[model samples]
Target: MSLVLAGTVAGLVLGDAWLWVAVEWSPPAYAGFYASGGFDTPTTVALLVAAPVKAALLWLILRAPAPGPLDRRARALRRLLYLAVAHALVLWYPIALLPDVVGAVFQLALWSAIDVLYLLVIRWRSRMLRAAAGVAFAVELAGTADEVLDELDLPELGSSEVAAAVLMLGGAAAIIITLVGQRRDGRWSRGTQAAGWLSVGVYALVIPFGVFFEGIPGGGPVLPVVMGVMALVGTVWLAATARELPVEDRPADPPPARRRVTRVAVAAVAMLPVIALIHPEQTPHLTHTGWSPACYDRPGFGDLKPAERDAAFLCRARSTDGGVPPMFPDGLSDQEVLAYGRVLCRAKDHDEQEAVLTRAGSARAAWGADPWDLVYVCPEIVGAAHPELLRSAAETEAANDAHIAEMNAECRDPWPRTKGVVQATARYFLFADGDHGYLVHDPGDESAEGEMDQAIDELYDDGDALVGAVGSTVLVGHVEDVTDLCLTVKAFRTAPPRRLAGWDQVTEVPVVSRSGRLTVPELDGGDAGAGAPMPNLAIAGKGRYRLRVHVRVGDAGEEHLVVVFPGASRKRLELKS
Candidate 1:
């Protein structure tokens, strides 16, 4: 029964916030063990079985006839044992198990109430303690009922809040009453008597079934109700079983100072283990070297060994000496190599470290191959020169930007404005160079306009113009000829160059005005520049003409340009020299 009580308290503690406290107090080694599934089966069963056994053993010991006076050390050991049992039943078990939030609140209330009742009983030798204890028990019953009502999601105060509030208030009142009763009786030691009786009730009634109740299927509601019924049954049984012993037969109190000292010693010993249990620390000898079972040792880990495991751990350590080694040397498999590569790519490597990256164009490809192996085998190949790399990177960047824009369009959100500016700037440079190249500029600041202008001036020194600011969105074009040709613009914000195709011819007609104006014949045999202000025209072909504006600023506060071509191809535009 005592074991059962301790186990019940333990369960309550486990399910409540006390469990978190226990976790915090647990030694690092224990915590690691707990984390690694050490407590999953055996520990749980031990706790359940041990509580009742300990309680029964204590009951038997306490009932045993008094022995001859013991040695000091023996007495101390006995006291220590008693204290250990009390602390475990009162603190450890309660905090480690039991799921009822309201039950916990009620249990605390009952404890307090019983304390008060015992105080009153000792002070007056009055029958009022039993009544008071009964009343306290009743309050606990009411609180549990309230909790059940709340779980049904009734309109009343949900769950334990109201029950806890009532318990605390009622318990406080009971304590005050008991204190007053004790003072009136001039019995300063009544508190101790009350505690003894309460302990008896806790041992005999609360634990046995408390442990049993928690184990039942659908136990939550049923357990509390059954416990309440049991409390009533137990109260009746105690009343029926009550027997009057002669007053002189009761144990006499020891001297006040000695008794106080004894109680203090007992409490101190009881608290030692609790304190130790509460503030767990790590020991050097029990360090864990492997991954936690909760994480790395889970299901599907078996699928990870050959390729996933190898790729994840091996390739990363591979040497920097270039050229692929046999798929795996030294018993290492391809998957392991890939895994190593993947991990290595993410790790910090020196500048000269030549890393291999396998390009799986899509996610499907990525998942299909051993992902880890792909990490090492994938080559991050870039153009040799800075300009070429920049150009390729810019095209790749532009394509990415366009894809984002497409997604944004479907979502009806404004396209990213910064991307437009970058794309336009990249296009302007790409056209002037007439070949793919890298854009060398300070990455620390977005104000790459100065660097862009320098690149433009150096690349196209004659008869070229930069007519757009970084933040404009519209693009316009003028040209002098008509011909079949392809126009490609590699934007820094796009993933790849955009090839505008199907042009007949192209001609660069010089503008006479500083405002960058030029005129060219229209497709309908009329002057296309006649009634409008002309921009300098680089015409594509004679009859069916297309034009390209190297750079233009738009009204929507973004910058980009339209490279006009009749079809999508990389063929060069024919320039009339």
Candidate 2:
């Protein structure tokens, strides 16, 4: 009865956690940004996927169990425990992947050894599954807090000395509640907990190797799916524990372990959070090393193992002579050579670095705006030299400036003075990070993906456009029909309300005005920069400006309210009477 009760409680808490994430935790703004913009990050994906799995398992548990319910419940509860640990491992494993195949194996081997040794030497196992689960939960919500805070820009919450991530401890709280409640039921013996942790740890060690080397079913996001499956089964197992059964069927607890080792287990489990918190920034590394490429020698990374500390940081490595790297087309890969060049570019002496800068400048003149070339790579190495790279083509810059001035004078400012409409393709539009995703995605280009579906059913989902904006530039979506898209423009001195009444969706982006005139081009047109000239909005002086795009749809066509502010884009554009 106690086991059933505990299992029932565990089922409820797990369901609740899923409910909390799906409903209360995920903000509309942040979640929508990710969903529509196609920014499916790992943590975001895990949180979304785990919630549904837990919910489904909760449903499965609610149904009547087959004969021998007690045994089924016990097995299910054990899987549930493993599932919890799997969620925790999702965050830790990504850090390990960047390290070479051998480094990953070694880390897992050491962990497995310690896990085995705990049982052999101390006669018991220590598990930090819950603590790790907590850290993973915190990390997931932290991204949400960051995104929301970025949008809201609250002074008190945003300006605080404490990291905004700390505020997103709701996930940690949910896991803690589930673990604490499970402890209330004595049926959750130390042996049962140990077994569950062991199973999950093995999965963590084994899965990454297959993902990194052997290849998983999905090309990407295999970890989240793997963790979600473990958790799914685990939840179902817990729910089964609530089944009606005899008390005599309950599993027996193992004998108590050595007294001294209890502290060891607790202390060791406590350190897992420390290890989980240190997220290292990525360094450019074409080759796999003994440690994660990102695990450079930073002071606070004391939590990192010794192997990681010893490996030279990929970015700062120098040649044999400690001078500039070997000339282009050396033994090193282009990326490695670039890293060395960047090292020389950052050097203090201009006279010493002048040769490289001059060469990069000449390359810029020859390449002329082709991306990923020498001109593009050098700027990140020395940002101040960005203009210097461009200045090599003085005649070109002058011609471009003259062209801009000519275009600005020929501004297509049409609205209050003359009434007309702009043409739009259809309903669903998207504002995304990459320009090529929705526009001009070359059919032959293998690298271009995650955009474009020609099927008409994709356009008819709900009739409303599923447009989103992660950044200002690219907008793409499905629309079955093309129609006249009209716009009502207003200019404000101050930043206006982000959304307006009756608009389906609204977003704002900062746009630069070099000629005091900015154009609103076809964001969701056929080919990029291929159609007719777009109308321009003129401002008084040069600087930064904001474009607040308010979109709404009707049976006839889609309507847009473009509000322009010096920054807010809120001021009313009072026409000259």
Candidate 3:
């Protein structure tokens, strides 16, 4: 028994040391789901409780007289082991109360299973005690019902978090108190004392640090292998020790039955908790489960393993459905639209991505008009991975040109003669960041250049120039060739299609000037590398104004439309298509 405790102590110490090595070698990549780790909170709470309980059991066992009959020492050890398990059940109770009903059944079935095992070992006495414990636990917690409710309503905490925290704490305290009451000692061993304390001390430090900090470095794979091994070893150790003790000299239970039954019962007792939590939604922290996966597979997806469903549901996907990034439901900002483009860039489901883009572009338009997002989505994906289902950039641009040439054949309204409005054009190589200019209220700010610098990763990863943000500025993307661009300015009385087709995008942005006037930068395609930012043309006084920039693409060039209004938000509205 003492030797078994020593192995546990050694395992705990070595595991923590390995953890330090892993963290130094390969720290967490805090970008993925779960802040990029597994179910961090519940697992941490479990470890905090389990460590001290196991330590107390080891101490109770060591205090017993060496390898003797079923005495006071043996009974005390058994009761402490029971307390460790009941504490685990207490931990599961709140976690099981998640969003679905499957979790609830799993929880109750698990409690029933544990009761079966408890009765076979400790007889009828354990059940009576368990029922009494349950009653007392409820009564004790009833006093703080209002506090729990208040905590749940807080913005930082919710039903899942608050309930788990409160119940887990109560469970831990109950476990410790129950173990303390069964304290049996003549203080038989100092070496055993060292081993038990060492296990408790190391576990308390390592588990919490691993959870709340940068996360276990190689913890993704390393943790499960180490924990699984420890569990197997502990089960074997306890089972072997239990064989030596005589719980009773009753007639119905023979020697052979006691030997085989006792060992098997001990093993099942250790494993019942593991069996209870097999649902994909409630990820098993002690075992290997994909808490967050990279690729999402819809019903029509060719071949893939099941990822955590909660993650997919968050992306608005389900078992038979496809998903989009969490955007589009609310009014979008320029940054949000830019961020959505980035998600589309990395999407594996090319067909689904294209469908989402095309559908959003075309069908959502009210009357007969063009899509505002016609300039977006595909170009963004092209810059990233070149989505499989979409056409090549050359083909798409050629189609856009032919589409515009057809639209230009229709009679259109003349450009509006309005103040606070001017048109400027430039030659930009689409794939290259050559000489593409932007619309800004402050010509002197140069923050647009800083904004360009901020998009270095996008540029490096996908050769993209289209996505960026700076204060009071809206940037443009690169084109395939240095195409001839014609600028056009307009002011809309009401939101409607200024033209029937050929419009790629029309979105809003703020333009402010305290000096009562500012210069709009001219794009002359000179030696400045990116359209030569030498100030030139028109100026306008502004007070609180927003620019609704319109981009209409054609074979000849792109006609940019900037419609000045009194608001600032990046909303890609539908034109009557």
Candidate 4:
């Protein structure tokens, strides 16, 4: 019990620590997904509850009275144990939202099948736990596969259907094997044993899978691999100890309750209150108020007096327009809009001002069409103090244009500025930049020379290369080329050359030196001399951005992308070249 408690605490702490470390070490390409927070109080609650509940369930099963004629108690206890382990694991797991409710449903279905199999065929509780844990590993593999498919631009293949199908096939195969084994011998068949061993192998395989596909889940490699290692260890322990350490003899009487079982039961009972004490009722944090421009026509606004209606209009307009980046008509200047805004601000009664503005709008709408956004009598708000209110309509239009431009220049829209990915068209290139920049090679415009520098620079630091707040460590120069070379963009893996939206473009760019046409396309085409930066290298930000072109090393099958940081010593510089 003491060992279990200590290990549980250690596991929790280590899991949390590793989560943070993974977040820290994750590549820039995958960092966007993790920019939001991770495991919350719910995960902690789940973890705290899982172990005790499992122990309690196990104790109950151990204490159940034996069956009179048939092994009914054993069968019942097997079912209970299966339910316990499966529920515990499911509760402990933090499900991702992308797959939504389907993920949970699939998890339930897959784990339940494993549970049923253990209940029907497997006699040893150890094998049952191991098999259930193996299913968990399989689920992780399915999840990783989905992520990999998404990255590869095969989104259709990455759907929940694929994951569910894979899990179902695996589950069905295991079940069929178990059934076949049951027919061969009442004790258990070779097929069942084979399946159990195969499960162990599958569970063990996840550690390597996590290592290889660390960048796939955006959750980093450490956590998944650690989880796999733990699962494998548990599986092995259970399998080895099952026969030697059977819980009790399957006899007519209930087994004597051992001190360990009693202790486990007491601990489980105690955990309920602790869980209740620590349980959190999550209250959503309201970030902003939702207001719409078209709310005036809704139920509440009807039947108001003209003055009140104007006030309502003003309220709605101000709620939507205030604090937002000012964008007046083309002719309006920022100074003029500010001046008008200041005039509007002078009105002591907002409702009265709204009424006046409404009337003005009505008159304009009746006589000639006026833009809804154009505050027609804006200057008139201060007509008593300033004679400029009597200015010609043409002057007002010009002022409005000037106001808009000036406001836009001064006030940056937070959404665009803070967004992780800035999707924009530059020449024919569909360029998106966050922590790293990605350039889709749409070469409608032959000279992409100076077009992408600003977008590229925004993602990376000036001079030597330091990635921006929302930039990938490795900037993808071009995704569409012959090789499906995987490059690390900071902590994430980005492979390219798949189809994207918009015009088709040439993958390779012609290179020109002091001498005309230095290298022919085919003769020196493949990742040779540093031609126009293809999506061929990891970004090395040394004060400036440098592309580390990966070249084949000797005649070996394996290849490594050279690490090039600009302004480094000759060794690094030569590597960059």
Q: Whose lDDT is greatest here?
A: 2
Worst 10 residues of 1 by lDDT: 237-246
Runs in model 4 deviating more than 4 A are 1-443, 451-577
Q: How accurate is candidate 3 locally (lDDT)?
A: 0.38
Once superposed on the true structure, which residue ranges of model 2 sit more than 4 Å away at CA? 1-175, 185-187, 193-254, 258-338, 343-403, 407-577
TM-score of each: 0.23, 0.27, 0.23, 0.22
| Cα RMSD for candidates in order | 22.4, 22.3, 22.5, 23.8
Per residue, candidate 1 scores C-alpha lDDT tens digits across 1-577 of 5444744576555652232123222233433333343344444444444445444444543443233454454344334434433433345455445555544454445444444434334344556754674575556456545555554566543235565667534533443444444444442333333343333343344444543343334322223322333233222212211111112133456779877875674465335434533433332211111121222332122234343433333322332124433222333333444454454344343321233222312212222223233322332321121222223334645665574344323321122332321121111112332332222111233433364454445334434322211211112222322211112222221222332232222222111111222132111222121111112221222122133333212232222233322222332233421
Better of 2 and 3 by TM-score: 2
Off by over 4 Å in 3: 1-160, 170-210, 213-577
Evaluate all candidate structures by whole-model CA lDDT and list the values in order: 0.34, 0.39, 0.38, 0.35
Instruction: Using lDDT as the measure, name the better of candidate 1 and candidate 2.
Output: 2
Tens-place lDDT digits, model 3, residues 116-151: 333333332355555554553453343234344454
What digit string (tens of lDDT, one per residue) describes model 4 on residues 1-577? 3433455566566765443332222233332343335456644444455445434333432333323333554445445444444433343334443455555455445445544544454443456545654564455445545545554466633355555556535543543444333333344323223334434444434534443344333443334333433343333222222221223332232244543464454355335334534423453211111132233342232234434433332333333244542122212322343334444445466564454444433222222212221223342444445544444446655675564344324322212322211111111112123113233222232443554555476434544332221111223333233222222211112222222222122121111111111111110223221212233222221122222333222222212222222222212222221
User: Deviation in angstroms for 363 in model 3?
Assistant: 38
- Which pairs in model 2 have colliding backbones? 76-237, 79-234, 80-234, 429-467, 430-475, 491-571, 492-571, 495-568, 564-569, 565-569
